[model samples]
Target chain A: MEEVRNQQVILKDYVNGLPKESDMLLKTSSTILLKLPKGSNGVLVKNLYLSCDPYLCCLMSKSQVSHLESFTPGSPIAGLGVAKVVDSGHSNFKKGDLVWGWTGWEEYTIITAPDALFKIQHTDVPLSYYIGILGVHGMTAYYGFHEICAPKKGEYVFVSAASGAVGQLVGQFAKLTGCYVVGTAGTNKKVELLKNKFGFDEAFNYKDEQDIDEALKRYFPEGIDIYFENVGGKMLDAVLLNMKTNGRISVCGMISQYNLNEEEGVRNLSHIIMKRLHMKGFIVGDHFNLYPKYMEMVIPLIKEEKICYIEDIGEGLESAPAALLGLFSGKNVGKQVVVVAHE
Target chain B: MEEVRNQQVILKDYVNGLPKESDMLLKTSSTILLKLPKGSNGVLVKNLYLSCDPYLCCLMSKSQVSHLESFTPGSPIAGLGVAKVVDSGHSNFKKGDLVWGWTGWEEYTIITAPDALFKIQHTDVPLSYYIGILGVHGMTAYYGFHEICAPKKGEYVFVSAASGAVGQLVGQFAKLTGCYVVGTAGTNKKVELLKNKFGFDEAFNYKDEQDIDEALKRYFPEGIDIYFENVGGKMLDAVLLNMKTNGRISVCGMISQYNLNEEEGVRNLSHIIMKRLHMKGFIVGDHFNLYPKYMEMVIPLIKEEKICYIEDIGEGLESAPAALLGLFSGKNVGKQVVVVAHE
Candidate 1:
């Protein structure tokens, strides 16, 4: 058997607040074999692209009896990753196949639940897209908007964190559907990307706007029919005032308030009941079965160049921490993916 | 033509805090003639049962902006009321037809848009039920639970303000669907009403429970699958901790935080993204067209005694302000209604 080794990034400890580079440490270790043991159904993979998402910060935090489990300290940090199968014992996956799912933040991984992994059949696009635009983040924007908000052709759609992974895709999808799409970004460059790259009808730099209510009014004069909520808090309160009757809001994330010791108060949520608005929060995994359907629709858009995707790629595992922390600070331009090793 | 005059309940001035009995004054004058004038489509009606909803208190506050329109300081206060058609030039109605919609707080009202009025078809149920269970509150609960939450059988359901107007009906509906249901009320009496009268599996008094998280754990050992949110703030924070993966929260109101100068912060909303949960806020008026469907489901339940309703009735128009303000104080046992003059 070939010599086996895994380069892994482990969580040093449960973080109290925002994670620092010291919280994670990467180490190279030797493995006995790449093959699964007899009678075990698993796949061994050499991980390539790893996703650095905002939610990973929450996973590193101390367990506060949340709805999800905190990532175990000392265990390898796990997230969406694209990898190639070196060896396999599962029926669905064979040796030398490319796959993507919850893989270790490492150069190699032994995934037991190989069923969760999706085999890459289409190689027409960049393989790294599997960790982002064609993966969970892409499906997230698609299902959250199409399924949750049920956007109409002429609806007014607003997305917060508009330059991020899911928000960027949501804005694009809205524009393609003939929506009057507006988005809020943290910086002018991201705002420009929203309008020029993502094709959003209007874009605003929330940081520059003195008043969020005034900002929303300038973007949505007739009122917002759909709000793709990613950054919550004052943004949500302002959006509530600008919502028309029968508005729909898809809650994907609240990145702004996540790390705060005390959460921000939202004063205008009562408008949901008054204006008859519908605001729903969702996750991509719950709607994973629709991935195939999402691919069917999105693949063509990418092929035809009707849809454009921007990704801020960190060169190696060493830069993963900075890349992840950048999400909170709005530093990443688009879908943030860490390149562990080039294919 | 009858002698032309208008008796009205004028808002003396916008209130600052909890509205007092003196904040609103009922002024009497001669009855206005029921005439369409030369070319008007307006219908004239003699006001009957008027709805006393919690939202009216917000309109009374000077600091709050009324969502629809501010009640003119020197003019009559208006709300959803049932009225008897005295004369009509509008196409939909004629003299003697009973109707319900927005009407002024007076003996007689000159309604500009008769189209907003819904004709009374099922007078079999109490006409006041039209303002409570069969009206906005009822439809609110129905669409909020059925459409928003999309609850499944055997799911664990929790409702706040359990014995209040909309909460009572939501709990009953969950029970009917074979779900495990629990509720929170402000008083021991209302808690008892939730368990015995509303058929909730478990009920607690929020006032008695110092630690809401502990209280939620006692009722939901496996965690909550659905939360019908009425009382926002601390209760919402606690419920967020107790929500299951993919939990659905239908935000109907936040009675606890509404009157506050600053709304309370919800620390556990981050759970929304981590748990892949859905928290939706909706208004009843947005789903008004579902009234026929709601009535079809609710009317039979009422007739079969499967649904139980409670209303704290005030005697006349003069008592309307006190009845409405009672909602914030937890004084109203169930739906609060004002009996101006029952047909």
Candidate 2:
């Protein structure tokens, strides 16, 4: 039996507040057996691309673990990734098959539950696309905007964390539905990308604005009809005040509140009553059934270059920590992806 | 034509914070003609029972008014009430018809839109029931609990302000659905009424509990599946933490926050994301279309004595201000009704 070095990113300890790069350690000692052991049912795969998502921060804390499991200190941190099967004892996948789903943050991983992975069919698009635009973020944006928000033509829509993976797509989806779309990003550059590249009606850097409610009021003078709540806390408070009668808020991720010991209080929830708003929180895993329907709509747009995707890529496994950490500070311009291998 | 002196409750000014009895002045200056004016399209109604509701506090504030109109200074305060049509110029209403809908807080009122009034057909039940269990509170509790919450059999249900007008009915409705029902009130007396009269599985005085979250966890060991949100603020904050996966919250009113200049901020809103909670705010006026369906179900319940109703009646128009003001202090137990006339 032959073994090979597998560089891995391990959670150093349970994170207390905002996750720092030092909270994760890059180790090279971990190795993967070249061949599967006797009676093994797992598939051995080499990770190609790994996603750096905001919700990963929630899983870092030991206290919050209902939706996702907490990252153990000594083990490789796991996340949604693109991988190529190097060896397999599973019937569904064979050697050289491409897949995406729950995989370890390592150069190579042994996927015990091979059925959990999604087999890649389209080789025309970049394989890294599996980590973002075609992955969990893609499904979330589709289901949340279309099913939850129930966007109608000419309605006013707002998206927070508007330049990030899911936010960018939600804004585009709103625009495609003939809705007036506005987005909020942390940086001026990301804001520019939202308006110019994503074709949003208006975009603003929330960090530059002194008052979020004033910023929302300026963008949505008639008041927002639908709000895609990606960053909760104060943003949700401001959006609640600016929401129109019969408004909808799809609570996807509250990245701003994820790292806090006690999440910030939202003061304007009474507006939920006054405005007759429907605010619902949903997870991507719950809506996997919509993936086929999502692909039928989004694939043609991607093929025709009608929809645009912006990605901020990190080069290697060592860069995963910084890429993930950058999410909190809004350092990444678009979808944050870590490329572990070129293939 | 004979003209009679009409006693009225007039708003002194827009209430700043919590409303006081002095904010509404009992004036007897107005007079109404016994007969309708020629070429008129209105109904002259003698006010019978005026409902003292917590949402009136929202109307007291100058800032909030989207669906309902705000009361102007020196003008009569308007609300849901039971009235008798003394004279009718409208085709739908005749003389001596009992009706309920929007009416002024006066001894006699000339209702311009007689079409807005719902004619009381069943005289078997108490006439005051038209202002409460058969009126706005009834429809609100019915629509909010059944239509919005989508309660399932054996589901754990929690109602805030459980002994109040709408809450009491919602608790009973949950019990009828074969749900595990628990409720909270400000006083132990109301709590006892919730458990004994309303048939809630358990009840607690929220004021007694040092930690509301703990109190909820004690009663709902499994977790609350449906929450009828009447009083928002810290209680809502606590409920958010105790809500189960895919919990539903029908937000009817936030009485606690209505009086405050700066409303209390809810801290555990993030639980909505973790638990995949669905929260919707609604007005009974929006669900008026469901009233016929509501009456079809509730009239039988009332006739069979399957549901119990409790009212704290205030005699005469002079006690109107005290009754309305008492809602903020939890003074009047059950449905607070101010009787202007017996017949």
**Best candidate according to TM-score:** 2
In candidate 1 chain A, where is summed lDDT lowest over 10 consecutive residues?
A: A62-71
Residue A328 error, candidate 1, Å? 2.9
Model 1 per-residue lDDT tens digits across residues B213-247? 99899889899999998988888889988899888
Q: For residues A1-343, write the lDDT of model 1, one tens digit per residue.
A: 6666667788999998778888998776735376777887899888889999887888888854344468888888888899999888888888889999998888788899899999998998999999878999999899889999898999899999989999999999998888999998998999999889889888989899899999888878899999988988888889989999778888888888776776777767667666766666676777888988999999999999999999999988878878888888888899999998877
- In model 1 chain B, the worst 10-residue window by lDDT is B61-70
- RMSD of model 1, in Å? 3.1
CAPRI tier of model 1: medium
Which number leads on DockQ? 2
Question: Model 2 Cα displacement at A260 (Å)?
Answer: 0.9
RMSD of each: 3.1, 1.1
The local lDDT score (0 to 100) that residue B300 gets in candidate 1 is 89
What candidate 1 gets wrong by more than 4 Å, as runs, is A29-40, A64-69, B1-7, B29-43, B61-67, B86-97, B122-125, B296-304
